[model samples]
Target: MASSEESFLARRIDAEAFPLAVVDVLALAAVLTIGVINHNGVEYLSTNTVGWLLTLVPFLVGWAVAGPLVGAYSAGAAESAKAAVPLAVRAWIPGSIIGFALRASPLFSGGFQWTFGVVVLLTGGVSLAVFRWLFFKLRG
Candidate 1:
């Protein structure tokens, strides 16, 4: 039990994972803005930080969980560190699956479809690519 706790704590403090999580959260925020639009044609998009954060909860949860589970944030993987883009792409698979599942809950009004899954996959991969690249570069 102590070993498990320690492992959990170590993962929680991981520097690379921390930034990746932030990137995931921010990416979903952007996705919500770009993927959904007011058909009414507002001159500008309004900011609702509270509402936006609420909507992002599922994505954030998925991303944070996926990194540790998939070894995306594992220490000392030199080859993966050298190829962050592929790592990002691979990590996004399970990450987005969890995101899709959570976001599909009835709590969210946005209906999930095949295309939404694809959008989530693409956006998440792109998002992780940029952030993880930065992480690898900085870590080096």
Candidate 2:
């Protein structure tokens, strides 16, 4: 890439992309873990870590990929609650839909769980919005 483009990519990814991702990943994990612990106990989390990871990691990677493509975290996007929250919601829905589909696929050993999809949609959507809100608050 050209020097100017490279710098833009570097700055945006480092400052915005990574931070949004970290926030999103943690939000999903925290909510998911809490439910699992309540229902299955803490030991279940440790024992089924691989399974949990398989369920969780895809959303992070998915957001990392789609967030940029969809302009979820772009320079032109407003960094305010009013603007940021909607953009984040728009960015997350498609990826969440795709993730749900994949989780439902027979190829997945755990099989389809509609409740899981709903939880992810609700938790991930709200979390991404919160990230955008926080991102702007931090910037100000």
Candidate 3:
């Protein structure tokens, strides 16, 4: 009887691991997609190398924020979405700032200025929200 119970528990653990892995993969894909779209649409002041570096800034910052906010890597999928919101907001601020600064660089023909800033802020917020929503759904 004890052996049977242990086997059942192990199966449950394995089931849970699969979903968590899926969530992480989805989150990573979403972030990467956002970066690619933003880079393709926006013109930057730096050379290709600099532009690539700048492109990663927002995604990295957002990921850092989301990881702690949603407890993605540390707390696991069982954490509540409410606990993640503040961290998401904190992450958005810096990501927006960095994105805006990059857009203003003279490497591009015309600086997007306000438009780019708004887009970055919106993108960060939306991305975080979507990620959190998906996380909660999967966890529940």
Candidate 4:
């Protein structure tokens, strides 16, 4: 049994969390796009939007599933870089792994390679951590 105050607090947190989640999505898209361009070249993005989407969607789905589970988009998570960076990295590990699994699926054209997976794990974590830090720093 939740009180009216508790319900209102939950609603308020929900309002705040939605926008944060949207920004998280945007940040992830940017990071993933940069990775694509780095590996596949800018022409790949311009010439093959479907390929780009196929490459990108898995990771987005990964984060969409992982972020909330790991509290990456919570109000508390957004409160400071200290909180955000660790949570972002924690979320990113499982998220990127899920992306790799999705990439290996027949629905997407790409297959997972260990070297590429390692690169994604390392760079994606760093990118997300830096992004989270910057997000908090700039917001503050």
Backbone N/Cα/C clashes per model? 0, 0, 2, 0
Candidate 4's TM-score reads 0.83
lDDT of candidate 3 over 59-132, digit per residue (tens): 46545444433333333333556644444555557655644555456643335567656665676666666776
Q: What residue pairs are clashing in model 1? A: none
Which digits, one per residue and each the tens of the lDDT, describe model 4 over residues 1-140? 99997764553343455656666777778877998898889999989889888888998899877877777766777567787788778988999989999989987877989998998888778877777677667777
RMSD, every candidate, angstroms = 3.9, 4.0, 10.3, 3.8
State the displacement of the C-alpha of residue 39, model 1, in Å, after optimal TM-score superposition: 7.0
Model 3, TM vs. native: 0.48
- The TM-scores, one per candidate, come to 0.67, 0.71, 0.48, 0.83
Error of 4 at 65 (Å): 0.3
Highest lDDT: which candidate? 4
Q: Candidate 1 lDDT, tens digit per residue, 1-99?
A: 469867875653456455555655566567655554543122334555445555566666776777566656554323344644665567678877887
**2 versus 3: better TM-score goes to:** 2
The stretch of ten residues in a row with the least summed lDDT in candidate 4 is: 8-17
- lDDT computed for candidate 2: 0.67
Clashing pairs in 2: none
Q: Sort every candidate by lDDT, greatest first.
A: 4, 2, 1, 3
For model 1, what is the alpha-carbon lDDT of residue 34? 59
